[model samples]
Target: MAGHKIPHFQNDAGHSAIEIGVKEFMCVGANPPFDHPHEFLDMGAETEKVCPYCSTLYKFNPALAETETVPAGCTLTTEAA
Candidate 1:
């Protein structure tokens, strides 16, 4: 997992819950400039998890791509090293 490109998402739209494909990902409260600390979340054996930083709930969706989100615009294109 050293070179894995972990999917990162942001909730700029302030959605109460977001549907994502990947069970493991990073939740950035909002887009940079207003974003909270990027928190890595994993939903192992579960369908959903909540971000403690933003209190945003994330639901797993098998129908979506690993880098996709239900409402869209939640996937962060640019990532930091």
Candidate 2:
């Protein structure tokens, strides 16, 4: 054989790993008590947005800061590192 190519396979040998890091994320939304006269004129005004997963009410002030992480055996920890 001129050259042997090694075939790659996925295994669980290195599945368990841990990663620790910090990130800053900002969430913004349309101003509540909206500044626009047209919006205020509307009787049914929905001013706030919510997070689908956490159901956090989106706001304009102080934004939102959070520490997010994945478990030791999570695939994200392995791929994102």
Compared with the true structure, all predictions reach lDDT values of 0.87, 0.23
- Candidate 1's C-alpha runs over 4 A off are 78-81
lDDT minimum window of 10 residues, candidate 2: 34-43
Model 1 residue 15 lDDT score: 95
TM-scores, each model vs. reference: 0.88, 0.19
What does candidate 2's lDDT look like per residue over 1-81, in tens digits?
A: 124321111112222222212221222111333112111111123434333323333222223212222332211111111
Q: Give per-residue CA lDDT, model 1, range 1-81, as digits (tens).
A: 345678899999899999999888898889768799778888999999999999889999999998889898799853542
Best by the TM-score measure: 1
Which numbered prediction scores highest in lDDT against the true structure?
Answer: 1
